[model samples]
Target chain A: MAFEFEYSAKNPLYPVSYLKLRAMHSRLEIIWTGQAENQAQGLAQRVEQEMLAMEREFNRFSEKSPLAVLNLKAAMEDVSVGEDLFMALELSEAFRRGTRGYFDIATSTSCGKDMVSYTLNPKSHSVRFNAPEVTLDLGGFAKGFALERVSRMLSDEGVERALLNFGSSSISALGTHPYGEWWAVGVDHTKQHGIVAKEVRLKDSAMSVSGRNYKGEYHIVNPHTGASVAAEELILVEGRSALVCEVLSTALYAAPKTEREAIVSQYDGYRASEILCGDCGSVSIRKIG
Target chain B: MNRKEFLSDCGKIGFAGVTLSLFPWLQSCSDKAKQEVKGEKARIGIIGTGSRGCFHIKHLVQMPNVEVVALCDNYRPHLEDAAQYYPKAKLYDDYRHLLEQRDVEGVIIATPLYLHAPMTLDALSAGKRVFCEKSMGYTLDECLEVYNKRKETNGVLFIGQQRLFDPKYIKAMSMIHEGKIGDVVGVRNYWYRNNNWRRDVPSPELERHINWRLYSEYSRGLMTELACHQLQNGSWALGMLPEQVMGSGHLVHWLKEDKRDVYDCVSAIFTYPNGVNMTFESIISNKHFGMGEQILGTNGTIDLVTGMYYSDEPAPKGSGMHQLIAQIESGVMSNSVFAGTSWAAESSPLAPGVPIMTNVKVVTGESTVGAEADGSRELLEAFIHATITGRQPEKVLEESYYATQFALLADKAMHENQILRLDEKYKIPYTPLK
Candidate 1:
């Protein structure tokens, strides 16, 4: 589970540090400055170890993975869950309710039964299924959860200026970049290569982007319809935490334009922006909140 | 009867049917029959003693029936380097002189792209069997001329398409033909590398000659060098050629100080007669995606490079006893439970790939050359066997012709920024020998 890393010298004077690796089928990059080479190496090793542990525990593809096991048996009986899994499930329920059911974990296309068929018991720290066909999938929120955890760990280790990018979809910044006033992150255009549709500055905020149309097909499924969302727009959300940003981005992308503002207003200090592609191939970007 | 006579007689009554029905008979032909058919060792002369030529020499020197008799290169340094390995072999400044050597029965053409067709045609016309490394020619006209000349001559003509002889590919292709993955819906292939793709130039004068792959006059860049193999795989798997191709390419990344004319990135989609599309991508800026071919089918997908086939159907669920054990391991329930509903989902949303040829053990490391050797060595062995036995399979030439045609056409499509339909006249009409 130790992912491959590619390191390159970002600069000679400041000696910027950059490390890239593959996780969850996408590229993850960690860039930082203001630390000695040894300290940076230690921080990178800890980050890699933490990320691998998270992947092992939550990766749904692995047959022996804890998430896979919980998904396999949580419906038949009350399955005793690990603390991490329990916390993730709890956060997922909160996000689902906060987004008015737009951000759902139990309503996966793979789940044949309805979301109401499954129940989580916080008192016993267990999950149970009311029906046999209910299932839970955490792919929508796992990366954000892992990113937030690693960022917190890095902060605790006294690492100050850093950028943790998870697959270019979810990213959290520790502090301002060394060379710039703030971390200047570009939101990639949906159709054009290397085109930045929008740029946002992050001092300590986290951002997540969700789009229904891009390369091949829309993989983001609408939980209410049990079908893929057909909108050709990208929704970008910035918040105080990675989890909230991840949840709101996905929810806003799937929600109608009229309801997106309402979803963003529910959280404090969170804003949402959308880049919509019209039928005639014109593009427009606007802030919804 | 002699092996040639036997095979000739068998060829009259459907070569495919004969190869199938007389499989045991051919196996029973004995060592004496094989020796009688394969009279002498095949002496091979290598043209263009560069990296690819040296690679061929390394494998050919190890082959039992092949003797590396001559080495040819216009560059003295490359010739001197190759001569270190084959000290006994004759060295030539010109390939025509190498072709004139009477002792050499066959030649391996590993020169640059521009020299492939002319060298192959000359070697074939000189009554020497030929195995030319692919992107069969520099241009479509040159490829067509080589094909026509090859058909005219009685000598065996084989292009270096090693994947056709690979055991993994053979097995996967057989399974695909047997409907293991159902009908092929599409094919996707990509090659990525993070390098300048330029060799160190000895001097500025020899830049174009030494780095011919990056020059427009000598090569078609990624399409001819990389996409040909994958395009051939698409055609071979589908048993038909692509009817049209549309593409876009740009020299986006290698633009600042690099003098190369070839595109740093290119992508194309080839449409087959059955409406199935095969997409190809190559990039020199980023190596994130690496390289592989994904053969997508209605029921499954096959990663050709990895030799793994992923079924659309999910893995079977654990049994009731197994589930109970799993539940107990997690301290969920220890006692006998009531018969609950079967909460197990039928199929997973994910695709877990299984190996196509499980018997072939995978070897990892720089020294482990099993996978690479199996394909190239098998191809060279086939060429040598054909030269010695005076029998070359017709399918090799036919495949070479069509694959080169598609590759060059794809290049044209990208350059012209338009869709190109394959002309029937470009198709080499020849029946494949089973």
Candidate 2:
């Protein structure tokens, strides 16, 4: 893995800013600025450290790692894991149930945890499970959540200008630039294709856009019926936190109309604007707050 | 903890688990078959068990096998109403406290709009089902979060979409679908009630949080509270959600900036997929005509207001095909039958026989056409039955979520005042649908 940084913003809401990006099989970018920029860098390093640790314990692609030891131990019925991995396991269980199996973390092509389930070892940082299922894909929002934890740490460490983007469609912003209150965010409306919707101005917020329409293709398929959400092309939501946005964008796409608005309203500090395109080529946009 | 939950949890998962909801299967069973084949009753607890809560409570009380075990509200007076129904049920002043009750199975949260999401998450996490009132929550995240959480929980959820349950709406939808008014091409929805509701000032702070539907904090103003319902109606009938919504909102009659953040009147146009457009208007200042959908189709128009369906009774018999046969018979033929004919002998170049559809009666049926069928009632009952049966209904979550998704689009369309795309992402940078 390699690390890189830059400061590119076109909305004019931000000036020269620092963006921390790391490239591996996938990409991870951490964008931070303002009073907390330096501390945010350190937090990014720590997040990288945690990522390494998690990879060591979970990565099946790495032969030198102790993952085989943990799996072999579980084969003989013995193993353990730390709190973060354990909580992730529990959360995974909740997510599977909550989404009625949508947004599944265990179903990725590579790096998904299909083969093995992580078992806990209350005191030690060690991990063990019955067997290797498939690769563990944190590509969804696990890495994003890790970045969120890191961002929180940066805030603790006084990193004022902090913005982090986890490769898969997730971003975390902390304490806007030295000049503004909220970051400027622009999105394309779903119907009037090629038209910009409202410009969102927010701070200490996380905005996540799920890929129902990416490069004009719907990458997400409803896990329930094996068909993609019928009309949702793009959904732009802004709220107090990205975790909420991360999970919401996933669920709202599959949500039924009767419950869509009510469901969107169930999160704190989050608002969503949806664009739906159908066979007729007419698009409709709805904003929820 | 309340007495009933305390006892139930004490009997089931023990003290630590009492804070969680208890599955109905844990109840005592008489026959062994009862334990295996039977499902648990849909348990429910209501937040702000006030006027609306009381109304929902009445419904729950009558539904067999279900229980209304917990009631919550910050105000003691509101709690009193629910307490009257479930005297022994737990009562909570802090709404979140109700989230910990073990026996509570589901929830009917009709609280102030601002508290919608916080209360919803707490309930969903606590493992209780939920039924939130209309206009869902204050922000998009909250709405989407509740939606996602509901999906995550796979719990039975119902929004207070009364029109979704109303017979009037169901019938109109079917008539349109059955093509009672010909192939529907356009529609107009209007909801203009003369009164914009009245509320007294209990206190300064209460104005913003309490009676919130009148303000922007709890509701999306008239668009959310009024137009959203009808917008849904039009979408259901037309078989598509709007992509771009651009409209104007004006607070003409009652204007109080400090107390309300919503416009009292909204005139909007939503463009649908098939190029069918719906013009929706809601005015609080003066309700001129009324509320209903005018679906313009190829044959005729379906008026949802009067529960009527009309069409220019199929064009006069032979008026169309007769002209063709007649023209052939009177043709100034050449020497042979296969020879070319002249345009001169044609039926009346200036005034042709009832020129196709132009000749069809503009008003085929009487001024008042079809009568009110129980279609709307059937639609409502279908939704209600789906909730009762645990069987996925016709307008399933996948269907309704898109509807809410559409409502959201209309708002953006109105805000941007330009035709916008429908599939907009939450916040990662986007390149629109078109």
- Scored by lDDT, the top model is 1
For B1-434, candidate 2 gives per-residue lDDT tens digits of 22232233223323222211211111211133234324655556778875656765665665455666788888676788779888988889876778778766667787765676777777777766666655565666666777778767766565555445333344445545656667767878876666646555567765554566676545677666656556666566666566666777767777753445577777887887777788888776665665556777786666655545555453322321122123323431111111000111112222212211111112111111111221222222232333344443323333334445455555556666666565455322212111
Worst ten in a row by lDDT for model 2 chain B: B334-343
The backbone clash count of each candidate, in order, is 0, 107
TM-score of chain A of each: 0.90, 0.68
Over the full model, what C-alpha lDDT does candidate 2 score relative to the true structure? Answer: 0.53
lDDT of 2 by residue, A1-289 (tens): 4554443333233323343345323345554433234544555567677666766644545665454444445444545555665566566645555545555544432223232244445566444444444334444545546656667866776666655555434556777634445544444344443344444554788766664433345556554554666654556566776766776776666655555577676565678767554543455668754
Question: Candidate 1 lDDT (Cα, whole model)?
Answer: 0.73
Model 2 regions lying over 4 Å from their true place: A1-289, B1-40, B256-258, B314-394, B426-434
Top candidate when judged by DockQ against the true structure: 1
Clashing pairs in 1: none
DockQ of each: 0.02, 0.00
DockQ for model 1 equals 0.02
